[model samples]
Target: MIHLLRNLALVSIVLIAAGCDRIGAPVRVDDAWANATPAGATVAAVYMKITTKDADTLLSATTTVADHIEMHTNSEQNGMMQMRPLSNVPLEAGEPFTFAPGGAHFMLVELRQPLTAGLRFPMTLQFQHAPAQTVQVQVVELGSR
Candidate 1:
């Protein structure tokens, strides 16, 4: 009886793992761009919307172009703009989250290389319940108001 129970448990685990794979198709990226900055002593922000069909979570991000990639959110403190890193963000089922400037965004800091206009960089994002998705981000020149 014990051996039979062990086999059942193993089968259950496999079923759960298989179900998770079909939970979401993939993460969709829209309107992605890296703003251009002046040469030397500058920082830039990335704006994009990550969407999924079912529930999922963003684990982490990696980019060879930047030294560090972080998930950040913009908040107003004492009438000043403040940004903080978030450990994780929930992706609701069939819901789209907007990541834009002065809001929830991804900050690429300490760029090892300069980000010039009309350049494309590769970035990879790992998801907790979905597969790791790599995306290409295009650099755009600074827009005049």
Candidate 2:
């Protein structure tokens, strides 16, 4: 009877540990901002720095200002800069993922309206292994970089 109880306790501990692995850790976004778009423009870019406590992947993003949002990376191909969609962005534990001009950024397409300077908006970021987080994004001028 004692051996059977020990085996049951071991199974219970294993199950509890497996369940804990499914819970997501926290992530943080900082210095999030969007570039101001000119009138009649239908697209804009957003930049930010993301940090995670555990390994995770950025699955997608959404904002009320745009009809569609996706992760993009700018690369030079054939002497021309090209922006390509990224399916997911991996985040290393305790490492910072930076999204800036001329690098990885959020491509906000089909703008609902022109993004004006000094305006702020909410952007929701979804992750594969973490809870979705919403952050405030500031709109800066074209020259702000």
What lDDT does the true structure give each of the candidates? 0.82, 0.92
Tell me the spans in candidate 1 whose CA falls farther than 4 Å from its real position.
1-24
- The TM-score of predicted model 1 comes to 0.78
Q: How close is candidate 2 to the true structure, as a TM-score?
A: 0.82
In candidate 2, what are the lDDT values of residues 38-135, reduced to their tens digit?
Answer: 88999999999999978899999999999989899999999999989999999998799999989999999899988999999999999998899999
Highest lDDT scorer: 2
Q: Candidate 2: where are CA atoms >4 Å away?
A: 1-25
* Pairs in steric clash, model 2: none
Residue range 1-145, candidate 1, lDDT tens digits: 9999999999999998888677646677777778876789445677778897668998778888888789999999999998889898899877888888779988888887888889888888888987898888888987831
Listed in order, each prediction's TM-score against the native is: 0.78, 0.82
Go through the candidates in order and give the clash count of each.
0, 0
